[model samples]
Target: MNIIKVRITVSLIFEKIFGKLLKGHERSIQAKKNIALSFLFKGLSITINIILVPITISYINSNRYGVWLILSSIISWMNLFDVGLGNGLRNKLSQTHAFKQYSRSKVYISSTYAVLLIVSIGIYLLFFLVNQFVNWYAILNVSQASIYNLNEVILLFVGFFCLQFILQVINVVLTAVHATSKVSLISVISQITALIAIYILTLFTKDSLILLVVALSGIPLLVQLIATFWYFSKQYKHLAPSFQLISFSQAKGLLSVGGYFFLLQIGSLVLFETDNIVITQLFGPNEVTSFNIAYKLFSVLVNVFTIVITPFWSAFTDAYTLNDFQWIEKIFKKMYLYWIFTIAVAVILVMISPLLYRLWLGNLAINIPILLSIAMVLYVAGFCWLMIHCYLLNGIGKIRLQLMLYIISTLINIPLAIYLGKIWGTAGVTLSNVFVFLYMDILLFIQCKKILNRNATGIWNM
Candidate 1:
């Protein structure tokens, strides 16, 4: 009888705590499930990248591997072409869903897809017109012999990237609807397909970066195209993007929000993604590989934190639109504990990273300074901290301050990175971000407090 009573008491307490934590929102509970699924799938996908890195380097000389990384980085620039529609769609959908406005959500979907299709086509045409004028070899710092190879691969990659970008609206829709688990499922399948294709290409093809990129870019396209087809055909057919369904009013609404998002993406790309280019310019292509390897190891924390926070983006939108300050306050308060936990995780990752790097890279591992490792840890730590609040800001559509901070950061990043890179080399490149991004967390934290207190004005409004 004593043991039975103890079990019953424990179960009751667990249920009480969980129910309180969930705050009576079915979306909150569902978001947790989605977060778990995303973590699992992204973990698997990241593993593929980790495994591929060393294999790719060993198979294709470090210089060529660096070129591929740099070129692929450039291709990623094309993603901003959507100009924030993806995230705007997410916020719009979540807000509509919060009020049970399903029809409005469908209109947003149609308008976003229509706009994205036009943007993707414009990008391809624009690239084709300009591709001949740009010296690919000079840009990548590669030999002239590889220029033809680079040209062939870049066109293929960019074409597929545009197609994939348009198709990715399906995912934006899924993410907005808080169907992120399905999004993860699609990502896992796509990564696995890419991995298999890459493996086969390594065995059958020469060390041509073009062939390698084809495998990298093409397989994911097939997967995304198929997922888009299935979702439109069945699951989200009611909201399926049709030419007739596009609305000028809805398009204006999405672009209104999306334009800010576009500028912010450019700011982020300049601040964070340009490091590889900076390193390549200052150090060498070979050093790019070394720097990015350490980055991948430390970036695990950012990726993990991202998986945790992604669900909250749209969830925050739903609660904020509904004016659930109590729930918002409760959730943000809980995230302080998460932020502490992530800082601790960053410390632990830094501590064991040397061994982890050796095990993962074996002979391929270059000697990155312990200091650089620590800096990378701090970089992601600050990044994760900023993201916790940034997502909330994005969700609530209070992005003016966030955008302003990013613009300043972007203007300063290139010069800061170069000046620092000259003095401290690799550590300085990442350290620039650490120093610049501190403003984001500090300012955003204050903004969150002001908004919660319902006294938001001045800089908060600006």
Candidate 2:
């Protein structure tokens, strides 16, 4: 009897192992398919931008390009208005969907859109006023000592740009609702239109620098806003703007979630862009150009990975809602390994980036390869951790924790980066990123482990 029982147990164990292997393989394949589609859109965008870099460089000088980079970076800081509401909405929607609370889900979704639109408009007006009054020429480090009257042009561009950003936020909300295919289509169309506008502007205009920047920045936002509103209006008739107000109580819920995210957003902007600002101040505008070039290249790699991982936010919500911890763990492990591999490849590409830059942009001032490699490694690791933590926290409706971690990391990063940059230059600034990410990742890991332990203990007792 003992011999028979042992043999049966071994057979059962083997069967279970085989079943798990098959399931894992299937899940990985599905994940890859999703990743591939996301990557296709991202890759196309990156390729187009890469091809344009040389064309733009040939037409406009490096100094103008550096200014454009600075202005764009400043505008990117406006993402603070997002305040994590998109992810918070997605989290709530996912949870609601899991619970079959469709009515509540719609209310949450509508209220989120309402709040973001109002906040976005306010932020835009604030920026507009600042741009109008601020003597950016005095503040900015441009190659030409004279401040070109770009404030009016930049303000106009940013105003339209803000509208576009609001539309994109709506698109993100749509994406959270599992409308990524539509989002991808809209993005491609908008980008193509914007590129064509830039090309035409470049061909005709004598003032290529200003014209190109305005066309590149302004047209797409306008096009995207139009397209997004049209699409969303058509599909979700209820999403139309109306006086159907969100109660203060509901507003408080969003603010509660978003407040933390706002800090995180601020911290993120400071952490990522502070180096360029410091380099611009300490070194010069030319160094900014070199750093921007390398940073742009690194950004492409990070964006590609982000596109792949983005859809998982909604999927994670679904899994969490179903009490599927095992599935979550499996996906997380796969993503971690994939990130390691992806970052390795990114580092290798960045190692050869200087050679590519020399061939493409002539002799740049900074060591492109080293800066690119270090920044690539730091950004990939840091961004990966940020994304993973955000998704995990969002799934659990723990936006505050995510915000706290980012705030702590950002606060630490600023002083550390400033100190390091003073000592080592751009490379030292890049190294500080590794430290920031390491701290956040360690904290997140500990927190996640504790959550898992409690969850597991509860399950075991049940």
Candidate 3:
């Protein structure tokens, strides 16, 4: 009788702590599904990326591969030109959906898509013309011989990239509706398609860089475009992006909300995106590859943590709408624990990085110093920590702190990175981010607390 009583007591204790018996909580259930699906898909995406690096390096020479990374970095900035409309729409749609205001959601969706479509068309034309005057060789800091059909490569990539910013709203909508699992499902399929295209190119093509670029950019665009169409046609017919549904009022509203996000985006672009450009300008394209190789290896852990936080972005919004401060408080306590756990994971990742890099890249593996590895680990952990609150801030559309802090960080980041890159090479570039994270982690935590306490006035005001 005593043994049975002890066993029952332990089981009850475990159940209460783990919340297994309390799985009926709506927010928890949504978070659990989102986490599972995101991991499943992001896992596949990460695996494809790991394999792509080696095969792509083999297919294209080192110089060309480095140039491709630069091209990707450049195009990534184009989305920021949306001026934060996509993210604004995400939070807006989440709020409107929670209230069951489906018409407002459709208007927001239609207006944002209309704006992006116009922007995409104009950019496609602008880049097409600008490609003539711009010296790709000088911009990328690559030898002329290393680039074959330079104009064609830029044009094709820009074409796909411009379309991606617009069509990717499908994902924004899915995420807003808290159908994050569906978003992951779409991502996994897109990644698989792109991977298969690259594998085909590797086998059949010789030294055709344009063909490789086409496969990499074009195939994914085709996949995402199709998926976007399929979703709108079937599951989201009401929120479909018809030009007729576009509203100037909704556009103004998105801009009003997205304006801050746009500023934050600019700050982030400077702070984070400039690393490759700085590396290329100072160290060279080959060095950029070395930096990227180490980053990709360790970024796997960061990416996994991101999968956990991403689904919660809109979930936090839903919870906030319901005024469930207790739930938010509990979830945040759990997030803090995970942030601590991430440090241990980062340490483990840095320690094992050597053998992992060698086996993954073999002869092509670059020498990653221990300090650089540690810096990268620090950067990723800090990023994961900030994200725990960043998502909440984004969820509620209150990001003044993010706006001001990121601007300050970006102003400090560039010169600091260049100065450090000169001294420590790649490690210095990674270390520049540590300073940004320090400010972000502290301020965002405070903001989360203030918001939870319902004292979100003054500095915490929208």
Per-prediction TM-score, please? Answer: 0.93, 0.83, 0.93
Model 2 steric clash total: 0
lDDT scores in order: 0.83, 0.67, 0.85
Whose lDDT is greatest here?
3
- Candidate 1 residue spans exceeding 4 A from truth: 1-24, 146-148
Q: CA lDDT of 370 in candidate 1?
A: 80
lDDT of 1 by residue, 1-462 (tens): 999999999999999867765655686787877876788888987898888887778767788888877877888787898878888788888888777787778788888888888888999999988887788877777777644566667887889888888888888888888888788788878878877877887788767777777677778888888998898789887667767778978888887888899898998898778988998999878878888888988787788888888888888898877788887888788788887898888899889988988899888746777878889988987888888888888888899999999999988999999999999998999899989988888999899889989999987954
> Taking the tens digit of each residue's C-alpha lDDT, what string does model 3 give over 46-119?
99999989888888867677888888888888878799998889999989988888888888999998888888
Candidate 1 is scored at a TM of 0.93
| Model 3 lDDT-worst window of ten | 16-25
TM-score: model 3 vs. ground truth = 0.93
Off by over 4 Å in 3: 1-22
What pairs collide in candidate 1?
none
User: What's the count of clashing pairs in each model shown?
Assistant: 0, 0, 0
